[model samples]
Target chain A: MNFFFGIQNNLFSSKLEIPIFKNDGTFLEETILYKLKIQDLEWKIEIFDKSKKNNFFFHVNSSDVNNNDIFFIGRHENLKKFKSNKLIVLNEFTSLVPHGYHYRSNLRVNINKGGFSSYQSDYPYKMTPVKGSVVTSLASVTNFNADKNYIFFKNIYELPIQENFKIYIVDLKEKKIKTFFEAKTNYSNFFEIKKEYILPEMFLVSKNYVGIPIYISEKNGQISMEHTNPPTSNILNSDRIDIVKKFKRELNEIIN
Target chain B: MKSLIRKIINLDFSIQVRNTLNIIPKGIQKKVSNQSSTSDAFIWRTDNNFTTKFKFSDILKLYFKIKKSHVELHFYSKFNNLITIKKIYDLDFSNEVVISKNLLGGIEDYGVFYAYHIMDEKKSQNISVNNKCYTGFSKDKEFYSFVHGNTLVRTFDYYTNNQNELVQTSFIKNKNYLIQKFFYSSEKNELFFTNPASKSVKFDINGKNFKLKKGHSKLISINDNFVKIRSNCFYFRPIAFTYNEKYFDVYHC
Candidate 1:
């Protein structure tokens, strides 16, 4: 029996429901739903619109689903890429290794209530709009929002040392270019604060890291955050920090 | 429970709707602020320091933001002691903005007792929200006497002796429309009958809905059953009663 299933590899455990369109341009509806086996756990998931054969449906047997506290799944694109056309979960038990390369868990966040933010990172190696290019590894990313005039990054200067993150602004409307900030080292993880009213600006980073806060006044360019004690050893490119993505929903939605 | 009582007392049902109405594009909102007779006083944030606190006022200026993490408070007063505050983000069971208003003696009298509303750098003479007055102007009288909220004894522009009111019998003999011409109408849409020679005013609301009308043989100022329009003078004033639905718009000038 020829069976088929889709495997989506993530840097975190569990799965993020990013509804993808089926061949018929809608959700693939499948009856007689069964579990896709990953290690000891068989989580129930559905695949639809078979190629006129139930043979098109099968099971995805990957690493064991050991970690349940997983909330988000992303790729550290600066590391080696994941297996093409395969689904893997990220968790405590999941391998930090790419198909043929070695890597480490570079960032971690603890969000409790909401995660229904509209912003999602595009796996630039495959999804980047630029022409055909080969990416070196999978430790980082750069974002381009259609609504923003500037491409903002916080961890650029620390490119390879800083986990290979790049923050740049591409003017979607004007087709211009603006590079806001990039981390000089792998220590800083930058993202946006969805809420508007908090006087103190917001960005999320691993609590274990000693990264200082940075901000650029929307009213004025006055930006300031924690000054590194050993300022000379700092990998910060700019004193001003920018929020990359705004989290809108509660934490539970973000957590699996 | 005490705080809940305060919320009830200082509530501006008008403002609740105003916030929603603001969301709508300007071209669509035909409904202006409601005709609320009541206004509230509140203790707003005195300063946006590390610690937040403030004094109360019967006259409060408030602005609300939906996406804001914490509500901001700003105060602009010519008075040396300016109060301000910034409330934190604590969304619990019955958390609300803490408020308090001054409990001093209220002011009264007429001719539009002017207090300034400093809006972003511009100073506008905004009358107090609540009618904290010793007495109210009789949209029902001639001379349109300005009575005191405190004494209720001191009179201006009219005979001082009369208590409940200053009558029209004496003033009409010589100055027929002098009250209409000289004395200002705190209200618009003031109804006057020159042929019949009786001064009466009514807010022309929703077709013949006459709320209140009063004046001399010459002129009158009108206040109606609907209070916000009354204080805002949307009804008749100075001249005869005129029905103008467009009067209450704050930004329209």
Candidate 2:
């Protein structure tokens, strides 16, 4: 509702900061919640718009220099100089999962068994899904709290339609799901993850790590992943299957 | 390496980027409903200090919308009960901004993590800090209390009628533990945790060390009577100053 201008009004400014909150499903609300201006000819300190009521931001870590990076998804090896607000863009489609957020995309895109895509709304237009082989099946997109290094989605056709929900804790920075359980009333009054949301138990554990994800069927506390190759990342999940050996076995023809 | 000091005071146009720790990145902040409505306001708040006092609106809904990264909090309330309306993000009026501080090292290449702040209460009188708990006057008219474990315990206001007389020292228990001494100073407006980690904490106050419910933070943070405990990142202000949960008959008084 108010604007403050100064002598260097004509000088360059960082891309005006914009806020995008993921409300529910595929809806987003935009607001210019934060503003930055030169304070005493030096610090371009960032502050709230002052006029706004409440402020919202994605989860952040304490180690970063600015202490306020926005969440983004892009390709691998993106070591490009950030040319102002535009950040780095990727040609490939990326998918996103919420961390401190509740909404999960549950949307899927191109690629074979474990392929997915997440674009900034404008990119993916054929949402209705055109018929045939080009289209892949949709998988349940659950929420996550961190910007993962690499992500792959498998069309999990095995999950049943039931809401036997339980809270799962993933130490994203460490890249692992610490614990999963069926919440029972008074069973776990507090969710150690976010200091909010106390459920009196009545939830259950589902998966461990990147298993068949499809073979992911549960009975009580035990889970079975059948023949699916384990997920690969900076760290190894299972000792049974060697991802390197499997890769060498299948793509021996491509490796020089 | 551009010193964070340099960036804080943005100078020079030819500044090139170096290590991941130099850039001051800004993310999208959104405004939610005030204590009045459930409808979305959709505004952003940049500056944050870890703990987010939940405005009357359900900030939890927003937590689910982006539930990937690690987010934790410490809840503080003057009402002594979660459902009570005197909580910092008291549902009776106005919305509160939520702040997020990075606990890990992720935003080096990007900008640093950011969140919101809970303003220091203006009317909170007598925020005294002694060797014991910080004691302060309550806005609550009917009674006075201090928060220990997500619950409020009534605190007896100390009157200085017997200042010069010597009396035998007796031990009393306070929030989550026992105490051996009680020193409430109105001159400095401070309450001391006097030997908080002592086998028995006896701040001459009248209260027993009852076990905080499962959802409460184990550690007690009392600063000159303006008390706040840390859970994950959020601060949980005790509903009242005593563990006497008398107001909360349902949970455990």
Candidate 3:
């Protein structure tokens, strides 16, 4: 039997951060942030040392993310009160058509909750579009629906299809343990981050093979995982070293 | 558990279909799938680059030969079937046409967005639509409409945007009326319906009004921002206006 197409083939593993604070204060880079405690699917904040200088952290006891049912601990964006937060259950998983040929795991995430705030950011690809050409393999200025945001891979690239993404949520208190979020769910559609808001490096390759990209993004008081696409070496008919150099220059322009 | 169940069902169904088809002869299966062929025009090399050359036929026909290694299980080739062919109007090479490929996908999709209006350095024109963004074209011979996924956003023509450096005008398909057409004024960002259901019907895009009046009930833009609804004899078919300027299709109905 030719059981072709619509099959999830690849495995992507990455870590996501959830930051929590005890009170409203000027968020410093070195602020001692509180952590989270997880018993099954319920999340509770863990109290940390007020004077202890450490990275903003959290905790998750469940090491087997694949076996356990995972949920997002989203805090209220507008509400100053921490108690206004609630757990957003993974209601449904909508599997969009497989966008890549080689790297198969393509999952879009969309989150929903009463108080949870949603923030968006764009991470341009390390490699800019070829000079004098407005289109690139990784990013483009999309005018659809008057959405001027830079679209990083609005659709999946076709050949040498090697890049795909897996989403992982790391507990702030437990730095070693990680959890995976499968976009396919039962109750509601996957929480799809808008294409414009998705930074290209968020789903880039690992350091050993493709050069790893470090993404830096901050919204409200959260120090989210920063990642970007590695310098695009696999572009067809393009010199790998030249692309890497061009991407470095472009990345510097975007960063500075 | 749900995915597992779905997987098992899909496996079972595929097996059944395979077994049923196996009863038929190989020649019959080939006939069923390969209705059209480009044997004479196909050019292939042993490089295994999976690059199969296509032969241009006419304004409406495109002959594609799928390489053996590149034949995807779902048939989404390197081109991904996103080629557009536009017929050249009022040109020296009246038989020539342009071919364009959309740069819609991410880096992994391989090819970049490029349009070739000249086959052999001479001007050519042709137009084609992407099946991903359009629906009902292959099935309906007379009409083509945008997919349901394109209900909110107008169909984008990236080939023209890159080639001509003009504001990209989109095609708004009115599914209700088969003959009535809709074109977007890129400068004004207004949707101009060639035929309105009624004379008083009004259309709005981002607070801009395109009101249809009595007599013609069609919208045409006189200038960048101003659009007037003229009824009979004034309305013309929407063509690629950025590339060809001599075809002054203006009339005051």
Candidate 4:
């Protein structure tokens, strides 16, 4: 508790400087987590109130400023969309006061999923603050630790008495599952897709980029979905449809 | 020349409108942007060092509801098994206020994940009439153990004695057999147990026998130096002796 307050106080007093990093173009594909860079190691802070509203402020030391113009940019989650907001240009250091209505829960000083830039010249790129749909083509930043964490998602349906099926790595070694992705219900039709279980290395690398396809099958008295084949990268120049296409292809491969 | 001047005036007017729209508040920015197609762009920079510096495995986040107004956070750092408890009073997205924090030796049992407050030993005492496995720590915080049925199934002790260094000790119990009675005497440093039999017979700490049909207590004495068959013995301090099958056998020793 003391350490947390100490960190926060140091941030506001400009004794601590937090670096913000971005890798949007060619470098996005190579790394699982992007690294931050510091222009002058300025103190970046986000203060929040009880109303679930937050304010972002940056304290710049006069000695650290090598340029006159400073550019501050913020990207935060808006409802369901994660988009970049307007860029502010500050001439004087005092102009870097607290601004904007940030969500309290989403406020963070360093461990956030956005970028900030402070520069002397005008921002080279045009700023689009409009709320837009999330881009699926962007490389995912999710990573799973084999020892502690797992990739968890659900495939739920409501039409037939509410069927909820989950996919999990039951056996990481053999990638074997006597029953995987099948909704455990009184319903007779339930089969899991098992062929898509790739090697541990490949599964860990590609699980974030793509998802395993669910295949529906009719066998004996049960009509079930078979879980087969591991997921592959859908990164075809930022097209999310690659995920659907990969699923469809795997379904066909299992059926034929 | 007149038409060219008119086109330049329109361009200037649109840019002015766009700049004016940006000045509106954030809540209104959404509605106004929906009406018009213009927007402002901002570059996003994330601190990637956060993810690299702390792996998800290192920190186990546990939430405990303290009253209705606030929620207590227990961040169990697996690196050193340090438990830091912080509180958020308003239940909003604001920074949490540190209430009280302490460092535990390590995760004593699998129940810590399910247990809200490990300090509250009663919370970890999971009991059932049928065959059940229970995990918890001893009172003095010196010893942690997992018991199944009537046996000290697994023990994790952090005592620093040359003879009995109480670090982590995981003992796998035979799942097929159910221990009807288990007694551990810290004074003697011995353990005793029996299998399911007549409920009329109950063994006390003095190794006095009521019935000896399925008693494996004598056999334990041969293998384990901590087991002795004697009468009029001094009761073990922090004795983890199970009197009945229903009681939680967590002792201070």
Segments of candidate 2 deviating more than 4 angstroms: A1-91, A95-199, A209-256, B8-25, B28-253
Candidate 1, B1-253: lDDT as tens digits: 9988655533343222332243211111122111111111111111211111121111122111112222223221212122433433432211222122221111111111111111222223221122112111112111111111111111111112111211111111111111111111343434322111112322322223332223212223345422111111111222122222211100000
Candidate 1 — number of clashing residue pairs?
A: 77
lDDT of 3 by residue, A122-219 (tens): 11122111121111111111111221221112211111122333233222122211322232111111122344433212222111112212221212
DockQ of 4: 0.01
Candidate 2, residues B1-253, lDDT tens digits: the string is: 5687755433222111211122431111111112111111111111221121222212221111112222112222211122111223331111222322232211111111111112222222221110111111112221111111111111111232111110111122211211111112321222212111102222322222323322222223233321122111101122112221111100001
Tens-place lDDT digits, model 1, residues A1-256: 0011111123211122221212111222332222222222222233322222222221122232222111122224311432222323322111222111111111111112211011111121111112111111000110111111111222211111223323322222233322323433222234332222121111122211123232111111111111111111111112111101111111112211
What CA root-mean-square deviation does each model show from the true structure? 28.1, 26.1, 23.0, 31.8
Docking class of 4: incorrect
lDDT of each candidate versus the true structure: 0.20, 0.20, 0.21, 0.20
Taking chain B only, the TM-score of every model is: 0.17, 0.16, 0.17, 0.17
Residue lDDT tens for model 4, B41-155? 0001011110011101000111111123322333323221324444434332112121111122332321111111112122222211110112222222222222212111111
Report the TM-score of candidate 4, chain B only.
0.17
| DockQ, every prediction | 0.01, 0.01, 0.01, 0.01
lDDT: worst 10-residue window of model 4 chain B: B50-59
